[model samples]
Target: MVKGKIAIRRITSPKSRQVTFFKRRTGLLKKAKELSILCDAEIGVIIFSCTGKLYEYASTSINSVIERYNKTKRDNQQHHVTAAEIQFLKKETESTMQQLRCLQKYNRQLMGEELSKLSFEDLKNLENVLEMGLKNVRSRKDQTFMEEMRELKRKADDVEQENVELRKKLRVLSQDHREIKGEFAAETSSSKEMSKSSDQAMPDKDDIPERIHLQLSLQPKAPSLDAHETEIK
Candidate 1:
């Protein structure tokens, strides 16, 4: 015959509760020991009495069992985290690929290769963008040209100034040469004049001896006695 099920309730009497706790605790421990032996499994049980007493059992050391459980739980959590990260990476890669494709299509449209998908408004916008870009390019070109022109003008001015300086130096050199030539010509003329005056002042070589004879004759000569006797005879 099958026995009726007993209702599970808290025992109201203190003594009865203590007795029930002891019996249940012993039975639970026995069951755990049998399960561990028969199944070759590690098992653990823990209980706390109402009086704050503690009881525990384990096929292995409790500390070792607890440590193994924590290690397994941590490993499982890490595996889940790794799977989540992989999923996130996959989604990120898909999003990036989608963006890349969009960019490629947009680039093709800009190059006028894939324009069938563009509406009139989009074409107008593209035209405006191209026009603006052209305007900016032209502006930059003009700016660069002006800058180059200014640089050339500056260089030309420098060259012109240098030429003017060279011309001034040449004029100074020419003036100095003319002055030196004039002084040389004056010195030459003075030398020629001095030579002519010296020629005019010098006496002839033939007259030099005659002039010396006249000077000797002019000196008082002693009276010739023979000449005076001849005259008296």
Candidate 2:
């Protein structure tokens, strides 16, 4: 009897699923090995079980096969560029170069260079453009100069105000210093006067005999002998 082909579906039984997985994994690896040996070609197979187990077979080193595959993919991509695409790229390049040249020429003209090829009308238009640009530049320059001047003036005013405040502070300090000096001088003078009075009121003990001698010397002397005789006559 001819058996019917089994339908492809998920196996619900755990035991049957595990047994099927083991058998398929072993068969797949065996087929890969046989194919590699018979064909003498590189082969690689990777499988993952429902339990997240990894199984792989490689006739050559896996790394070498992956590198060769990536290199071939890159080569195929490079070879896939058509003539139309090349032509389109060339056109784009030429357009970009042409625009660059035009910009360079325009810059030279603006700089008053390469004017020999310009017509009279073109030169007139260029002259107008240059004049307008110069006028704008001068106007901006004047505006910037005025702004800077205003800023500088403001700064100078601030500095002047600061100087005024500082001068006021200095003046106040000077006045305070003068007042302190005057008070100190007055105190010093008072101290000196008090000291002098104390000295006069309380004379030194050693100076008492000298003061007494001075007073005796200053007293009126007794009349001389001649003066006394004249008085008697």
Candidate 3:
């Protein structure tokens, strides 16, 4: 007879461990077969070795056993979802979501404000965007003003040059006026003397056309420099 209790410890020696494993494995398989045949028990046993080799036994055909188990589970009102049922549920969910979107859109149209769903945070974000746009507009306006100011300053410089030329022309006209006055005085005296000596009178003053010129002070023309021009030493 076997001892009252065999010490349940690992068989340390390699050969001894292997022998124990083989004996236990055979005994377990035998007991399983006996239970299946004598007691009509539906049994499935899976055994693995330390090296990961597999051994399996089923009292009936594995497929039939699996099918019978599934049927029994269903009869007991198990809530497990089969692969097909899971796929069908996924499709149904997608369809429901699509319909929900259409209904939500229609409801929003009836309500006349689709943006009412936005929360405070969403409004704040929108406000920030609008503020940024306003800031950008102001910045662009300032930049445009600066550019226009620069152009106006350039035009003012040109006007100043034109004014200087006009001043020069005015000076020339003043000098000419003085010369004309002096010539008239000399002619009057000389003509009085000639009348006193002869009957011929000084010629009557005729209308003389004076030509006025508009002088524009232009910047000196810069010499054109060709891109290919180079000094070779």
Candidate 4:
């Protein structure tokens, strides 16, 4: 036994093999105890002979080590449930992983990548979402268009008011010119009559009634989205 490292090949002699087993088993138990004590670690050792004899050692109380061993055994046994449960859990895990992969694929598709292997249900749902999104975009666009129209109308009103003011100023300038000409000579009676007629020509609320009517009539249309399908998904 002491000549060199023994061959890993099977031992032919029963007596010699038994002797080696006993000696090695004793040495292993001794080492385990020493290591446990030096490091303050819990240790348990169990050995079974070829003849089916059981041997055990523990650094702490044997009963405590045995209780721990039993707990470990129970845990190990419980961890391996029925084969049916294992299969069910495996199927569930596989299905979840597949769904995750499909969701990632769909996300890529939403970014405009061409794809393969998607279901009809996935396609239908995607179409619905896209349609709804487009509808919202159209609604917002219409809102902005209406607002821009209103702004344009307001600018037009401001321009018209400025035009009216300019017209008034022109009339006043003409009147001044007439007065200056009259101071130099005699002014025409027809020019003074033209000034009185121009003052009476300024616009009233009757001219702006159409614009007010348009503002009063504008309203937003509601989105015609379906309710049932959105609730289901």
Candidate 5:
């Protein structure tokens, strides 16, 4: 005979409740295992008894299933973080580009190149900024001019020092030339004095008359023209 269906209510007897829990747990695990095998699906189930006993079923290792679930969760979190960072950076870049474009537009307006788009007040403000810039530029130009002048003055001082040194050298050379000329004149005078002394120390012809006569007597006489002609004959 077919058994009548019993209503799913709490069992009054502790023993009956325990028996029911055991039977239901067994049936759930058998169905999970069969489903996994038939469908080639990964499945995992975990249950805890009132007495703190653990019951579980998994098509694969329970640890492997748990590890895979955790990994998938972590990857999803990391992907979200990366997407958020990328979006933030894109926004930051766009904001910076906008600021740069604004600055460039302001620069063009300041240079008076885009005056048609400017109001009178904007033009006045631009004019004031330009005037200030012009003043700064002129001040810098004056400072540069002063610097160049100072540099030229310093160079002139250096050149003057060189000129002074050259003049000192010229003076020294002139003094040396004068001293050499004086020495040369003194040498010439000394030579002249030595020649005069040698001439004076020699005996005069008049003072050596007897000596001169002896010299003449020692000389050979020239042949007379008449004697030469007789000899020739």
Candidate 6:
């Protein structure tokens, strides 16, 4: 006759539970050994009776099997951690990429390259922002321009002062030059007049001798005695 299937539930009686645990423990250890031999696998089994008796089996040393199991569990946990970190990085990268795309779109909109989606209110706000930015830029530019103009004016004033000083120096030099030239002319004229006076005061060689001869010839000739008696008769 065929037997009915066992329900496999916990036995109510302590004695029956203990018996079932022993039988199952033995069968489990035997199956583990057989499986290891058949599949060339490392296998381990462990059980505890209701009375707290320990039972165990291993294809290799129990300590070695336990160590291998612990090592494998640790490797699996490390792998899971690594995979989770990779997934998180991928998610962060995707989020960053999305933010980058948003920024690019916003930049294009700000540059007026993508205006189709902007509402009237948005356009008004953008216009106001642009106008404000323009005003600020113009204000800065004007301030810089004024500063440059002031600098240029200061430099021009400095140059003008230098020119005035140079003119004064030139005027003084010119006056000095004029005074030197006048002194030289006066000296030259005085030397020429002295030369003329010296030439006039010296007597000529022909004048002195001719004057002596003229004086001698002009003396009255003594009258002859015969001419005088003829005149008287």
Q: Please report the candidate that would top lDDT against the real structure.
A: 2
Task: Report the candidate with higher lDDT, 3 versus 5.
Answer: 5
Off by over 4 Å in 5: 1-81, 192-233
The CA lDDT at 26 in model 2 is 96
Expressed as tens digits, the lDDT of each residue in 96-198 for candidate 2 is: 9999999999999999799999999999999999999999999999999999999999999999999999999999999999999999999999999999999
Model 4, residue 213: displacement in angstroms? 94
Give me the runs in candidate 3 sitting further than 4 Å from their true place. Answer: 1-114, 199-233
Ranking by TM-score: 2, 5, 6, 1, 3, 4
**In candidate 3, residue 114 scores what lDDT?**
71
Off by over 4 Å in 2: 1-31, 35-43, 46-93, 202-233
TM match of model 4 to true structure: 0.35
The local distance difference test score of each candidate is 0.93, 0.94, 0.81, 0.86, 0.93, 0.91
Going through the candidates in the order shown, the clash numbers are: 0, 0, 0, 0, 0, 0
How do the residues 40-118 of candidate 3 rate in per-residue lDDT, one tens digit apiece?
A: 9998787888878887778987667778888998886777668899999999999999999988885564444576887
Q: In candidate 1, what are the lDDT values of residues 204-226, reduced to their tens digit? A: 79999999999999999888999
Candidate 3: pairs in clash: none
Which residue pairs of candidate 2 clash?
Answer: none
Q: Residue pairs in steric clash, candidate 4?
A: none
Ranking of all candidate structures by their lDDT, best first: 2, 1, 5, 6, 4, 3
Q: Residue 16 error for model 5, in Å?
A: 36
TM-score of each: 0.43, 0.57, 0.36, 0.35, 0.50, 0.46
Predicted structure 5, TM vs. truth: 0.50
TM-score of 3: 0.36
